[model samples]
Target: MCRVPPLSPRTSPTISWKNCINESDPPNLQCGSIQVPVDYGKPHCEHFNLTFARIKTNGISCLGSLVYNPGGPGGAGSDVVFAHVLKGISVWSAELLAQYDLIGLDPRGTGLSNPMKCDPTIWNQRVSMTPQNEEEFNQLVENNKAFSESCRNLTGPIFDFMDTASAAKDMDMVRRALQEDKLNFLGQSYDSQLGSRYAGLFPQNIGRMVLDGITDVSLPGTAQLLIKSNTYESTLNEFFKWCNTTIQCALINQDAPGIFDKLIGTANTNPIPAPGCSPLSEHPCRSDATSEEILTEVQLGLIGFNGTVSFTGWPALSLGILEASKGNATLLSRPIITTPTSSDFSFLGVACFDCKATSISHIDLLLKRQMTSTLSPHTLGATQTYQAQAQCTGWAAPATNTNHALKPKKIAQLPELLLVNSLWDPSTSIVWANLLREQLLSARLVLRKGAGHTSYFAAGETSRAMDGFLLRGELPEQGTTFKS
Candidate 1:
């Protein structure tokens, strides 16, 4: 159970704001910023700025501003909406651009909202963990240690305070600033957790809400990490299935398993060049084929709200892989960054602050216990283990009461919530969507049978269903799963 910490003693309910309207910025969509208290409990204290953008509805019957968040924990929703989603919406694209205000805010410590900037060089450097020997493995540990230290040293108390719960409070502040009675949440991936938390915190204020590619906040740390590890295995298997069919993939290796082995083997022994020959040196290329680099690239390709967004960038990926197998490291220089964007990282600080911050000692003990058990051999020393361990060790956050992290007792009282999942989503799985549905009890599910993280935007029945749900508060029939 997640317990709410004593609200920061330094927050103001009334948000202050600063606006910059360059009438000449091509007017793609209206954008602005809001200054919210860095701490929510103290209504009359110090404040931090958060940026927000709104795309008003056109002629269609306005159903209140959809306060959309495209889950990053670190991913920028405002940037995504302005650059992609809202930009693609037909009604909002032309006439309704002015009518419907599509709100995008860089939650605290993200984007321009009291942004957290780490040393770019230190933050972007990535060292592969697929070590050639024990020495290399030790080096991998050092790399991780250094990376964690770098983040801690560079970022300040702001980094320590960024968490989803606080961000939810910021969302509420956004609603008030826009003068909306309630919020229509369009949240994906990690953002789903945010949306669910918001609903749990303030069910009465929920307008139409859709949570895509759900995250199960109810799961204990060990179980949640297990699910994430298992997801990687499943998604990689699925990726190989696709790779095996393509002539390029087939020529490389006829079988799915062998393709993986060959890719890993070649990358381990040699440096592959980046894929494209662009003048820019940082772009993906063939010459950068370190097994670690290849693995990172492929993982990024395979994982998302739905597995397909990576596909959009696959040609470059394939080219990079092909070049690497042939021995070129120059082409893959660009993908080596270790730190995630603001979207990829949410409030690790706040997560720790909300629930007691995790510790490496606990993680080490859990990993040791798991290793001694009969759990999958692959489960012992994995990415999720390292991720959780690092955060616990790196962040010196005080834990909030455990109850602060727990889900509420009643979900049926809220509006009919739609839970979207991709059959092949790698980050948050169909299993997670199921878990979320079970928790909400009254919520409906829409399964997109395609590649991607969240399938709402992907082509197929899922897309159609999402369109229907958003346009009209209709939920897909239970047990109805759509294939890509």
Candidate 2:
């Protein structure tokens, strides 16, 4: 059994919880900030405020705080709580709504916390994450290095410490500040890694933890990339399946797959013109749509499905593909890039700091591209892994936490964990859920066989099962499956 480490005495600056309730804020919402050490190795050296929002239950009985982290490593938990939970409280079960106070904390260096900033121009550059040749690859490396240096110069030494381990410790601090002996957490996507690390570090303090859209930290960079690419390819295949069967799809019975392939070929040789895009626009609305841009849009559209009865952007994607096939790129180039915010920097900073990158040699890059193409020939291996590799090629900061290699050592005293994953999830793969389950011996796996990213928010059976477990300590039988 792995022994949980004892928490150090509270040497960080004290934080006071203030009631910042406003008309726009969620009902029964209380907003506040807590001070935590920037570097846990030196708790008293320097501190920053971690902002949080809580929606206290109005029921007669209270069952402590349920802290939530909505992935992104850069995602603002407070924003999720306000926008999703509080706004859609009716979707939740009465038992869950009555019991736990939903708390969302913006991890250090994100959102209302001491957010790190960098030059927006660096991000605005129209560089392809998937470089086609050596020259483009070298340019990507230089651009990535410049971006990292900009972050280091702007954020200083603090940039080196925004790893997941630091965020996990900040979670513990939030628990202590809320005067709770145990923490109940719901972490999605990359935040699942955060929650898993927290559970490994402080098993004794865990109450009820649910990790949805499971991320397997055990996989090597290359393996991770391959798995993600293959999974995305599967999702694309699923989309094709839908297009062939469903009348709603504009490309139904039109050789959708062949059309998509020809569209990519055309964009590669001659970039399609997008008259709808404007140079003066704040968005990344380009005047032309490259093959890479169309691929990215399709990938994003597939990932954004809500697991509802109908897919969200399938029609749009079908129309976009049809339009691109006809030489009109107007729909395909509709501002894929949103305005860059602090979260953009935080995402890159935290991700690069948490995971060690493989060597960026030309041979290695070529091998990776070859592997990705082989595994996912249709998609051409374009996934988040490629993006991470491109951005972190010359990352300036060394990793503060090497906890990504943590295996699930049997800890008998740990609380039961609930893991959820959508079978066709575009971002996090179902294989990751299985890998994580193997490590977490006490965990119950809920497989939602449907489309979408995370399962809980869609108010499906997965959400019901999660609510049952979180509120009433009701664990579904091991290996249970739910249909979304």
Candidate 3:
């Protein structure tokens, strides 16, 4: 077991909880902030105030705090708690809700915390993430550099300190302030990396941790890009298959995949016009849907939620494709031009700080393009991977946390971890779960057989298993599978 120094009154930040629960909040919900060192490595340096919310247990018996992160690296933990958990409390398992107080901490540089900021004009520009030629690629590189500089200038040196390791340290400090000897964490998507790093740093402090929508930090940068590209291609194929059987599908009895490809080709040659789009002075709608916009919508649709609506079902995606094929771009362009908020900017800042390359190289670009083509040819290998590469090409901020791959040292007293994933998660991919399982010394893998991103939010068997583990310390049999 790892040793922790006794918490001194002078070292600890003040903890004061206020009744900031909104009308939408569930009973017993409370919110507060705690001041922490801006750079943990230099505790005497400047400090940042981190915000968090807690949903107190309803049962007579309390089982400490359960900290939650809804991925994005930039996703607001408090927002997730308020919107998904508290709002839909009925959907969650009563046992879990009654046992532990749900704690949501907006990590340093996200949400209620001192959020990272950048030039809105630079971020709002419609830049093609997937560049076709050398000139376009150069422009992308330049744009990324400019954006990175803007963030650095506005956010200051704190931009460099927003890495996952720093955030993980903040979590431990939160645990100390909560007066808990151990941490119970549920991290989704990119937050999985945060939780895993926390485990590596504080193994004995782990209580019952669940990492859903697994992200394998072990893979090399190039391999990571290929896996994501291939997974998205497979999920897109699954969408086509669903359309084949569902009569309500807009492209039913028609060649869905073929139509999608043809539409992309047409958009590549000439962007499809959206007549309904208002002038730029009035709204941010694009006059035409570029090929990049089409691909982006398809990618978002695969995640099962287009930003405007709750869930973008397969039928909705088919309808968008159908409209695009007929030379109308309204449906495809709507989600693309939706002006990004501060959270969106924070997402880029945190993500780039965590995983982006320090400097651009021609060899790296060529290798990425080749890998995307070879691994995910059907989808043209240009989605999130291409977007990340284009946007992070000339990222200037040096990574404060260099250890990307997490391998927790074996601690005999550490609690077994629970890992959950969908068999066909478009964003994270199932292979990541398999790889992560192997890396973690004590972990149980539960597979949710379905589409979409994370499984716990669905409140299905996978969710039940997760809740059981978090609430009662029950571990499902290794390699267990659940139908969503």
lDDT of 2 by residue, 354-381 (tens): 7777756666777887898887887887
Per-residue alpha-carbon lDDT of model 1 for 125-161, expressed as tens digits? 4544333345554554565456445555666546655
- Estimate the TM-score of every prediction: 0.79, 0.91, 0.90
Q: Pick the candidate with the highest TM-score.
A: 2
Model 2 backbone overlap count: 0
Q: Highest lDDT, which number?
A: 2
Segments of candidate 1 deviating more than 4 angstroms = 1-21, 85-99, 124-156, 248-253, 265-290, 304-311, 314-316, 329-388, 398-412
Candidate 1 vs candidate 2: which has greater TM-score?
2
By how many angstroms RMSD does model 1 differ from the true structure? 5.6
Query: Lowest-scoring 10 consecutive residues by lDDT in candidate 2?
Result: 2-11
Q: List, residue by residue over 1-484, the lDDT tens digit for candidate 3.
A: 3233333434656677776566565467788788777776666667777889887888888999899888876888888667645555343467887888889779888877878877877876766666656777678778888888888788766777888888988898898889888999999888888887887788888988999998875666677788888788888888888888888688998998899988988898799988767645454467788876788778778776222223566678888889989998877774323332366667767767666563255455666767776777657667665666567777766554556655445443457999998888788988888887777768889898888878887777889889888888889999998987
- Best-to-worst order by TM-score is 2, 3, 1
Where does candidate 3 clash, by residue pair?
Answer: none
For candidate 2, the lDDT comes to 0.78
